[model samples]
Target: MKKLLSIKNIIISIAALLLVWEILFLCSSYSKALFPSPLMAFYALIEMIRSGTLLSNIGTSMYRFAAGYFSAVAAAVILGLILGRLPKVFQYINPVVQLLRPISPTAWMPFVVLLFGIGDIPAIVIIFIAAFFPVLLSTVSAVGNIDPIYLKVAKNFEISGSAATWKVIFPAVFPQIANGIHLALGTAWIFLVAGEMVGAQSGLGYQIIDARNNIRADILLATIFVIGVIGILLDSLLKSAEKRILKLWGLK
Candidate 1:
């Protein structure tokens, strides 16, 4: 019932948005170059499909996203677990991490490019930095916030060491970890595209940049729409996965 209601709500919301967009397009007589209508954007999307711009661009962006996001997740989880379990070591490293964490990923791009050159490597590195701290910080906080009773329960069963850590603590703290992962996912996407825009021969980000330079407003708007649609899809998938895990843990 909940799922059905959600689907219905989504449909109605989309319909309402489309109606508003159409109304705005008709009521405002601005040049299409200034504000391309939804219909124009749709046409532009179709042209993109025929021109093979959409697929290749989206694929390249996804490749960059995957590289950075997966690496960040792995590194963050390992670090989170270590810091969470060993507060003394964590405290030693926390100040340096906090200093670095405050720096914006885009601010690091120039250094990354100087170090790695203009290529996928820099993009991947930027995405990793954008995503890493959030996940790591979240994991540390999640572990710290875990119920003491859970640890006691594990001890009652004579569980200790790595077994206790994984079988007991990790599962219990999953909800918070999921939040970190979710944030990292979106942040990675943002950084990936921004990195791509800086220096890329292929990618949705580059496609939009190129279209803007060429004064193709429709194509530019279409690319923006594509970015938004893909972002929504990726976030929805992550949230769904989170929901599934929560249900598995009886925590949903």
Candidate 2:
């Protein structure tokens, strides 16, 4: 029943969006070429799919996203785990993290491009930078705040060293770390497109640029819609995975 309700809600939301879009298109004075109706964008989306442009760009974007995001999260979580055990060390490192965290990933595009050149690497680097700090900070904070009773239980069981950290601390703090991972996923995905727009020759972001240069507003809008839909799908997938993991660990 809940799943059915969720599906119904999604359908209604999408229908409402289309209605609003059509209303705006009808009311606007702008030419159809400049501000396309939902139907026009839908047709454009079909054309791109038929041409295999959408799939190819999606594959490329996903490849970069997976490479960068997973690597960043792994590195950050590992470091966070280590630093989290050392509050004194983390205290010193937190200042530097705070300083860098506020800077937009795109702000480093020129420098990233200069170092890595125009290709997948720059986008990957941008995603890494975008995802790194959030997970790191969250993991560290979570670890530091783990319940003393959990550690006491581990000690009572003679769990020590890596075993204690992994079996006890890691699972205990995972609920919090998961929050960071969730946050990073969105940040990384957004930066991936932004990075691709400037540094990549191909991908969804570049498709927008390509469409704009050709004055194909329909295709541009279609690409934007596709990006948004993909983002939603990714977020949903992550949420499901998080739920499953928590269930497995009996943490949910």
Candidate 3:
């Protein structure tokens, strides 16, 4: 029942947005080519799907996204686990992290492209940079904020070192870490498009640029819609994964 309500709400919200969009297009002085109606964009979406261009670009973006996102998260979580256990070490490192974290991932695109050239690497690197800091900081903070009684309980059970960190500490801090992961998903996904726009030959971002170059407002709008839909899907998948993990660990 809850799921059905959620789906119904989503449909109603989307319909309302489309209605507003069509109204704006109707009221605007701009040409249809310059400001496409929702129906025009839907037609353009169908055209892209028929051409296979949309699917190919989506695959490329997903490949880069998966490569960069998973690797960064894994590295960040591992390092965070270690750093969480060492407050003094983190104190020394936190300043450097703070210094670097504020910089936009896209700001590095020029340098990244210079080194990696116009290919997957530059976009992947951008995504890595975008995702890394959030998870690392969150994990470290979560570990630091863990209740002392949990550690005591683990110690009482004769658990120590790797066992304690993985079995006790990780589970205890995961709720907090999950927040960072969720945050990173949106950040990294946004940068993935931006990075692709600057560095890659093909992807949803590039599709936007391509459409603009050809003066295809319908296609551009369609691609924008696709990017938004994909972001929502990715968020849903991550949430589902988080739920399963929490359930497995008896933490949900």
lDDT of each: 0.88, 0.95, 0.96
Better of 1 and 3 by TM-score: 3
- TM-score of every model versus the real structure: 0.88, 0.96, 0.95
Worst 10 residues of 1 by lDDT: 196-205
Model 2 lDDT, full chain set: 0.95
Worst 10-residue lDDT window for candidate 3 reads 243-252
Query: lDDT score, residue 33, model 3?
Result: 97
Best by lDDT: 3
Q: Would you list the clashing residue pairs of candidate 2?
A: none
Candidate 2 per-residue lDDT over residues 1-252, each given as its tens digit = 999999999999999999999999999999999999999999999999999999999999999999999999999999998999999998898999999999999999999999989999999999999999999999999999999999899999999988988998999999999999999999999999999999999998889989999999999999999999899999999999999999988877
Q: Summarize candidate 3's per-residue lDDT along 1-252 as a digit string, tens digits.
A: 999999999999999999999999999999999999999999999999999999999999999999999999999999999999999999999999999999999999999999989989999999999999999999999999999999999999999999999999998899889999999999999999999999999998889989999999999999999999999999999999999988977877
Of 1 and 3, the candidate ahead on lDDT is 3
Q: Model 1: per-residue lDDT, tens digit, 1-252?
A: 999999999899988987898898889888878778888888989999998979988998899899999999989987897799888889998999999998888888888878888878878888999999999999998888899999899989999988987898888887889889999999888888888887566788788889888888889988987898899999999888899989998887
Q: Give the TM-score ranking, best first.
A: 2, 3, 1
